[model samples]
Target chain A: MNMMTGVSPWERLIRPDRVHGSLYTDPDIFEAELKNIWYRTWVYVGHESEVPNANDYVVKSIGPQSVIMTRDEQGKVNLLLNRCSHRGNQVCSFERGSARSFTCPFHSWTFANDGRLVGYAFPDGYEGQDKAQLALGRVTRVESYRGFVFGSFAADGPTLREHLGGAAETIDRLVRTSPEGEVEITAGFLKHRVKANWKFILENECDGYHPAFVHTSIFGVADSMIGKLYGGASTALTRDYGNGHTEIDLRPEFRKRDAPMSWFGTSEERLPDYTARMKAAYGDTAAREIMIDGTPHVMIFPNLFIAEIQMFVIQPLGVDDSVQHVTALQFKGAPDLNRRLRQQTMGSVGPAGFLLADDSEMYERCHRGVLARNPEWIFLGRGEKRQRQDELGFTVGHVTDEVPSRGIWTHYRNLMEPI
Target chain B: MLSRESSATLMSAITAFLYREARLQDEHQYEAWEKLWTDDGVYWVPANGADIDPERQMSIIYDNRSRIALRVRQLMTGKHFTQTPQSNLRRLISNIELMDEQPDDGDIAVASNSLIFESSLRDDTLWAARNEYRLRYVDGELRMASKKVILVNNDKAIYTLSFLV
Candidate 1:
């Protein structure tokens, strides 16, 4: 009776210590995740800035389902299935626009911005049927916090506030830096396709161990900048912000370290005065928060990541491929010249940017290696023994440690396995 | 003392200079291309066809001479990973037309149709766009005051664009 006794793959995942490589590459597991995690969880869509006016809408994806996020005449935001009730055709084909109603291309079925059934091609087709119930299907819940929007698929789960937990403070800080207490997405976005597992981006961004090696060339250029400015000492500081978040703080010391003295002759003198002008405009506290020493890169677990001057949304296209959308953000009342400067700096990190291009190449190479035969697990044991607990109950490590990456993978495993 | 024939000849010279600039970019002769700009020249790739200002709408690429030089420096460095397996690109420019000529301000407005072909190890990409250039003559040489590119598929989902278009 017990002849077939053995550990199942599912059972193996339930174990705490390790995960098999199949979790990264298996088609079955990918399908399961699409159904259970992505479809069932509260996923981020677009920010409120995207649709600031009534009738404005943006197309987004939740799991495999394409949805439309729009504001109605009453100013309530609706997340409804993009498909038409008649023939499953996409209702809103454009990336974004302001429209009072969407008409299915295949059939002339129209739905209001509120997702209500407005009109049909033929009035005689459904003489006495329940036409009112044939409206576009809506998401289980659509909630927003600090202008960021999120939607859940399940009928029952924690609220958006509960889901964000301690991470809400980070978003608050981001908005508080803006003088108007709000920020809007700048026009145009940078889109790039990476040939790596979607989880890899989440892991790499927080993993401080790889940068000094993976980005040696970038550091080399930056080193020259530091040497010329600060007499050969680098000024970058990397810290682990517990619960899988890591922040890279670049300060004035970082700029001086290894920088060329000649590099600052023109721009440096102008920057401080400009910042001083901003300080006068927004007050000292706001200016200090906006400046933030150097640039601060923060990663919100699973998919959302924010750089000081930009916001990125990483969407999983498949287990082996992901699409990244990068958008520059602007404070409501900043000067034109300063906005241009921010855009220029943000450009250095786009698909065409020096740093991002190199990073994507490395990701592709890693994907290729993992796909090869006899691939071993990539270890994250660096600084594991030296981990020190912080006051917030998070373990901290040296700047060049794998603690952050391990933190992300640990959460990944926790989510993949049932409690 | 200039006649109509001389005016036509000058127009031809301006058109040739513009064509030469495109050739330099296609050949990756960035140093020579950089010389084709005025001191305050601007390169703009708007995200939308109707965009009038880079200050408001998002642009795919916007660079002044200094930022453009920085981009070149970054590309030439050893750390530019995205280009490890460097991409090779070839662009075709055609349908050149003179939209306006303002000799007083040393400026001319021109329009052209272009097609960009780029190849990498992963895939080959084709970008077709309409272009407009506002050139200002500096010391008797045509230099760009502004250059704008409007792509056909700017709003669709796209693969990595690791090179200039």
Candidate 2:
């Protein structure tokens, strides 16, 4: 219990039906979240395809702290702190580049791409100093699952597999879309800046309820068949796969159509070459199911979001600001499909997207609305009574339910509350 | 090189066309702006930088003629929230230069700089960019064949840019 407020953290901030508004605006709570959540968990760093070649490095952030994900000489991906150990200067300043070694500008301290101290300008000055100790600080644990890299600051906690839990199947489904069983993130990212708390994005990404109201303009409910995928009458299900991961499973609805590639708004005739390749790779039945199922609309807790043809990684800048970096997923042997994916990504995502622009506006409006102080709690009680476990043991509800947000908050409360 | 008089006339015509296009955009004259583009128009606003390939790398806005019409239709819907209460916008076009005097497939290239001032429901934002245009004459009327906007800070995080750049 807090000595000043005389209230336990979970009771004061999070509850089953609602969460306190202070969780979105308070600086102290944001700091605590940085410690308890972002720093402790296995936060996604970068994709292995991003650094496909040796010496390639991309600078990314765990929370607010900058770190570099580099491909060493042996092609092993390494996550090292961007800071220089000598005088706390940033070693690499470029967003991404292929460099032989990172040479710090301040003291001319040079380190190899894999965080090995190669040499320094004034070596005699540190005659007795242990150069091994001064190498770049590395994250305690680094793991990769099918080219998706994640890093953890804490030495021990949940492994990436344990953290992903049942959500790993969603990732497997995405990779299987490629005929070669590989997905490449070669296309650059589109960073959409949102003026709201980072958690809003986590909850909103899997949210099927608001798409009907929020994106009515894009979907054009009167004539759009896609409009029926969400709202009260839709048969789609929202699943809370344990450990804070969740999915808006549209398979039931897609299966109702009984058409292959209907999820992508395409069909067998249009992509015959792709269909043939998929058949050759995974055989006819599995490829047919893969095309029908499409990609998963899911969030891997804390950061990663797999949105069908695109992937989004949310970066928290502060209590009331965040940036969502998104990229169009490229299939390994599907050139025809990759072209369509790029065009669709442009139409549906980024700052000028038809769908995302309205969502961005709502996120900002929600942040501004929370400043009103009267409603101390944000309602998340929708579908709580009807939610039940599916055959996969995941908590399931209607597509328009708050089961995902409730699951996220439940996991968050467990992390924040004293054990 | 062309004679000085011909150069002056070309400059004047291009400048007039740019100012008129800017007015159409600032006034939200959707139909008039739509008419200004050729049937095969391509509107591109590259993300990261202007050098990346649009086909391989992601861009902020990359639209062919059909997509351009769709964008206009979405804006005209009166429901796209980013522009429900349309952003009050005015932009300054300057440093107009004729990059190519020779017509390549009936199109001449021109370049200019833009400083757009936008006031929306949230806050005011100033956007700076270099705009490159491919202009062509269709039945004695100047039409835009292509337009590419390279934002000054395209490499960094950018806010909602729903309005035409």
lDDT of every model, 2 decimals: 0.67, 0.91
Instruction: Please state the Cα-based DockQ of model 1 relative to the true two-chain complex.
Output: 0.41
Candidate 1 chain A, poorest ten consecutive residues by summed lDDT: A259-268
TM-score between model 1 and native: 0.84
- In terms of lDDT, the best-performing candidate is 2
RMSD of each: 4.8, 1.5
- Put down candidate 2 lDDT per residue, A50-117, tens digits, no spaces: 99999999998898889999999999999999999989999999999998799999999999999989
Instruction: Write the residue-wise lDDT of candidate 1 on A228-288 in tens digits.
Output: 2212233333445544456543444434443321222223234555455556766866565
Segments of candidate 2 deviating more than 4 angstroms: A3-7, A221-224, B100-103
Best by TM-score: 2
Worst 10 residues of 2 chain A by lDDT: A218-227
lDDT per residue (tens digit) for residues B1-165 in model 2: 769999899899999999999999998888789999999999999999889999889999999998888888888889989899899999999999998565657588999999999998778999999999999989998999999999999998888999888
Error of 2 at B32 (Å): 1.7
